[model samples]
Target: MLLLSRPMAPSNVVLLLIGLHGTGKSTFAKAATGQDVKVNPTGGVDAYTKECNKYTVDFKQRRFIIIDTPGMADQNTIEENLDVLQQVADQLQNLDQERVNGVIYFHSIEGARLSGVDRDNIRILKKICGDEFFPRVAFVTTRWDRIRRSEWDPILVPRNRDLETERMKLLPNGPSIFRFLNDGESHKAVLDYFAGLEDGTAANRGDKKARRSGTG
Candidate 1:
């Protein structure tokens, strides 16, 4: 689970990546951490990551301790999911900062609508990170590469809007949202937003337009 162990950088940011299975949590973790980091392959219905994983990724002169957690709603029983939630809590508490700098919640644009499982996952995430952390959160939509190039304008834009709107309602104080194309620059766009937050450049609810413009 420890992808890299090295001397800490100047600024160490702890980020929690949360979402359901197949939402590209591991993919992002492996890419951001490094190509050498061994991450579980993404596929199928069941979740491959069974517990919380911690990876150290250096980007733009910042060190990000990414805690990639198990997919919500993958467990058969509510009690089992609760146990995973406890695991996430434990990891957060164990951090040297004892606080998370930001949270990235992933969802696949492939699903046209948010199902019951999706809502349930969001609810569980709220419990894990708490309401005060909402402003530091980013609701990211992934798998844009799956859509055809010709449909990018017509299909991709509107879908992103709908997804953003829907997630806004679920999260309080309006956490910034962005699309993840599964690439490096896109990854930096997300990190840049959180980095801004860390440095006091971005404020919750006030810089919504600035956040969207940075990614757009």
Candidate 2:
């Protein structure tokens, strides 16, 4: 519920990562946190695991904690997965609302189409975090190199547009929408997105910030 006007010192914030499996959530968390990943207990207050890991990073005298939850689109019972997500939402609420800043939602270029599982997961996330959650959410499309421009462009155009529409419909006043392609070239863009979020700039605001701040 706390909207950061500027990126707080890393010491003052926590970031939560949510996406489907094989979406590069772990890789991103490791890259961002620079720590041994820790998984929350399955039955604890933060019982969101099976690849859902947590890590911490310190920058500019600030500490940033990131909780990486399992990819929702993985092979798991929808009920079980939703339960874990709910638990995560509860934990966030228990934490200082402001301490938990943004969420990175991963989407794979290989599987760009929103599947049934993805729709359900997003619904659950919206139910738990509220409609504005999407603005604070960034869509990270992984496996970009594997997608050919000839095939990817057309698929991506409508997909991206539909996704934005759905997200807005789900969370009419959400944070903001930002998109990124994951590949060798996209590495910097992905990093800049998070860094911008860390620095209090909404990474989804525009292409300019994304271009200037990304690590790729």
Candidate 3:
């Protein structure tokens, strides 16, 4: 629910999206590109993304390339997950830029709790980004609109806290959590945050911005 007026980010900013199966990476990708980039419409456990793919969007005088990666599925074996990692590595090696500007990691709030697969996926994500890129990482939780208003305190509040704890473990001192309300403006707010980083205005004040945005 963060409201950011359009951003003036540097052109050709590349972003990497990673998360477990059904976490809404494809949805976010479509939202970022402002188009119906091919994605599995089935909202099921079947893994839709099998490799690294890119989608481009031109907004607010800035160009963004969103790289969506294959996610870990519950049925996947260790080798399969490793293969997914390899796919991402291959994409990175062939990227137009030397490094990705930011990473948008998705999580689903509709799930009752974080499963072991979620934890493993986070570990793999950490390995993918490493310590140096932590500052550029943002954690996005999807499906907020699916939750009812009556459950805000009893359900949503605790889940948000647990997710914040996980984020702190990875980002520690910097600001990072953003809610994906399944809308264009919400998606733009997230991209704007990273774009602000490129403009040098969001570096020191991200904590405040994050605080204002994480109120979902």
Q: Pick the candidate with the highest TM-score.
A: 3
- Tens digit per residue, CA lDDT, model 3, 90-194: 765676433577777778877656666666766665666666666677878777756676886688767877877777875674455677767455787777777
TM-score for each candidate, following the candidate numbering = 0.79, 0.63, 0.79
Task: Return the top candidate by lDDT.
Answer: 3
Q: Which ten residues in a row have the lowest lDDT in candidate 3?
A: 1-10
What does each candidate score in C-alpha RMSD? 5.1, 6.4, 5.8
- Compared with the true structure, what per-residue lDDT tens digits does model 2 show for residues 90-169? 65555534345666677665654666777777677666566545555565555444556676556755565566566666
**Model 3: CA > 4 A from native:** 1-10, 75-79, 92-98, 203-216
lDDT of 1 by residue, 37-138 (tens): 444455554656776778887776788888888777654455665666676776655654345667788888787767676777677666665677666778
